[model samples]
Target: MNPLFAFDDAQCRSLAEAHGTPCFAYSGAVAEAQFRALREVLPSRVRLAYAVKANPHPKLLAHFASLGASFDCASIGELERVETLGLPPGRTFFAGPGKREAELRKALALGVRVQAEGFEDLARLEALAAGALAVNLRVHPAFDIDEGNRIIGGSGPSAFGVDEEDVPELLRRAASLRHVRIRGLHVFAASNQRDASKLIAIHGAVLDLAKRLHEAHGLVFEQIDLGGGLGVPYAPEESPLDLAALGRGLSGLLARHAWFTGELILEPGRFLAGPCGVYLARVMRIKESRGTRFAILEGGINHLIRPLLTGEPFPVKAVGRGEGTIPYTLAGPLCTSLDRLGEVALPDLRVGDLLAFGTTGAYGLNEGMTHFLSHPVPPEAWVD
Candidate 1:
């Protein structure tokens, strides 16, 4: 835990009392700190585009914008948020697999940088740009980016990028399109990877490809967009991310690409905002049977949604009128057994006590539901 509750104990308690159970609390300081740490590591040559899908709430986006960070949008709605926040199109990069033509048209109109996933997207973008937009090629690298098949792509097959063998033809096609400028290249491997070595390997591959492309086509890439899958420590014993290593690796790669003419781009989502927020749920019931204890929280898969769906483990801490330490099974009040957050060892959990779950910041709120008996949703509080 980042001592999230330590910052504003009274306010957190008040918010819980007023807003009822199943609320969210986010720390502005943590968010800003993460960005600052990233700035320290990111090469001076690259432009940082914070991926908005991690936490798209307007206030958070505005905070990132104020820090001079750019935006990476996945959909038209996200693009509109960028525009509405008053961030210029040049500062935002539009990237998503299977983007609709409407979204591409919006991106083109906004004059933002775009990433084309395949040959067809290139065709669609060229047609839509009508002589006005440029895009990077999103390449699916040859690696086991994901440990399992849960994510968008992995080793065997993926639908998110052009094949390595097809690069020349894709470039040839881009060369023909007068309106669409092929400005760069991109590779997004996976999310929540703990080992920094894996990231280094992945970036090494990206740079190797860039070097080959430069040699073959007389193409000097202005920008190399590396999609972010930076993971935050969700387990209590895990160490914080080694961003310094990532920075050194990335900087070295860009240094080798002296032929590249434009800025370097990084689209990081989880690293920027995932650990900044904590989910607060009220214990509705506590039961023990056959040497097992369960602290059933008021909210289920409906409010804090990702755990049940992805099996990603998050840490849970007992708060508000609890003892020092105890082992208990933490579960949501939902009927489905899988609605359980996980088996957690917390300090003396009791009915009606508040339980704070760590690292719920990335996918928790946005992926939550209002389904199953239509339980009222909780309020979100921003903390300093």
Candidate 2:
């Protein structure tokens, strides 16, 4: 069975039959294996913080927590989810562009580290912090970011972190803040990048940027967060990221940058969660419009919208159906014409034939427009 598809045809059929069509099934074993695979390759100084935006399934969170994984939370909801894990302080991080006061308060109460995106974040956090607090300053580097798909929106303009050029001014103003101290740096400049060499290049640039900040601004960093863009294969043809090479590159960076003794942080969402899931939906009907062959599934962008947003389809297969030369345009039950999963070549699909989408564990139902059509929400089965 292909590694991309967490469940085989037999398993897919079982999951569809057990959980009903248009539902999702995730393999706990696969998730653990993926975490261990990356963890084993990483240097001891590197910290793996599982990004909660990927899949906030309670069971998944608990499982990761049991494996001694730290969490990277973006919103109050994510923070709350991680809070339920009952982990100690310093294990959870709160990071977002526009954090509300309530969220900041909650983060402070929980002792979660905040990734301050701008001077405003620093000010807000300073006011909320009781005593001394350390935060990692998220920097939008001026360097060009090579992305296959525009997820983070490259270096030109973004609403995420403070721009690299404006860092000095921000720091100058932030020095006035009494409670909030910038002790670390965070740079996220890659998206869905599979090439290990390319990832290393981006990481190297971030470290170089950090070095400049340390030397020029006198900023001492205890942690440098290289934001998550770790890529996973969505198709069989695409190569998986070389974990060994990535590990070696990071180790090499540490060796080169001997001045920095702080731990490197990697927040991986999709890479850690994407491979462990399979979205199962049965073909509701088959339609041939003009020259396009359409296989309308029980679900569409409502359950998995990554394809619609990224123009890249998740690897899908017809359950129990062998490979074929027939082409298919997978559609959903939505009213809009834009509710397309992808156009791909699959075996001859029939009505009620089960279709399983692979690599959907991350941005599957959690990221979908489930409330759009008032359709019954699909149940997600966590397979052990």
Candidate 3:
């Protein structure tokens, strides 16, 4: 696994000093590079919509907007953020299983395309719309999904989209709606998947599902949304997603499914935002008990809870300490025992030692339980 840190040791050290400890610094250059790297490889028929749920920092949003990237927003606040970009209609999308009436109204007012979760969304949208409305139906496929992450619940049962088997009934009911029309198919069946072949397989399955809907119900889709599951490396031994393979696979998919001339949309939240961040904190203390070593830091789940939630730690490096083989269990200053980051090998540490966590630009401070112990919310510094 290549290091995902946006800055090197010297840069990390300088950022920590300048921003203070327990703060996050995001690299604007890295963010732009990531977007360009993914967007440039995609075919002209495919659209890249950055998932705002990943990291909603205004600077990040503005940067992506400047790069001609559309947005996939999930809530009223997110929609408000994208609204600030003043993007034209269709550049912003609203998708969530539990969208409030206010959010739907907001989306409608902003002229955003919505990925309706179920009949409720369709009915509500119809009730709210003044005229005709088009939406992409989010389907929860019955087929197995290979994802093993907590972010997307596995194939068993999900609260997302309508179930695949019920689509016929849904279409039947949707036919009666006066204003709402299902113009697209949205299937999100994978999570944090790195293998392009696997992602392609899942995407192929989604297209096949769309075909079934089209053939059976005469549904003509204007868009086929293969929801984002593009993975990024979290560990040194792990490999990043193969962009070339993914691009080629998608292009080939398009070629094979020539019956569908509609555009393809990918809502990538992490793949586009994960590598541009570094979370800086100082070692508050070191303790050894019961033969276990602990390097307790100034922050933990309070500011970065992914480790506790996913059991995978963001890559960390001790600033300016070079490298060492000593293993240390990282603990946060939280009062709960669940407030741990991860166990990793780093140089010998002491009080005031600075630690830098990489690949946290996606789910770092934003997803953290910031008010749990009342630690001041970490400042987010956008480094140009």
- Top candidate on lDDT is 2
TM-score of each: 0.91, 0.99, 0.98
User: Candidate 3, after superposition: displacement of residue 45 in Å?
Assistant: 0.5
User: Considering lDDT, which of the candidate structures 1 and 3 is the better prediction for this target?
Assistant: 3
lDDT, candidate 1, 1-384, per-residue tens: 244232344555776777666888777888898889988888788788999888887778888899999999999999998888776668988888789989988887787888889888888877776665667888887765544525655655777788777788888877777677766898887777767777777777787888888899876687888788777777757776788888888777767767666777877887888878877888888899799888888887777777777776566666655435566777787777777777766777657888777667677777776677677776777765
TM-score of 1: 0.91
> Please, what is the whole-model Cα lDDT of each candidate in the order they appear?
0.77, 0.92, 0.91
List, residue by residue over 95-214, the lDDT tens digit for candidate 3.
999999999999999999999999999999999999999999999998856688758886778899999888889889999999999999998888889999999999999999999888
Runs in model 2 deviating more than 4 A are none
Per-candidate Cα RMSD to the true structure, in Å, reads: 2.4, 0.8, 1.1
Give the lDDT ranking, best first.
Answer: 2, 3, 1
Worst 10 residues of 3 by lDDT: 144-153
Deviation from native of the Cα of residue 132 in model 2, angstroms? 0.3
Error at 220, model 3, angstroms: 1.1
| Model 3 misplaced stretches (Cα beyond 4 Å) | none
Clashing pairs in 3: 1-236
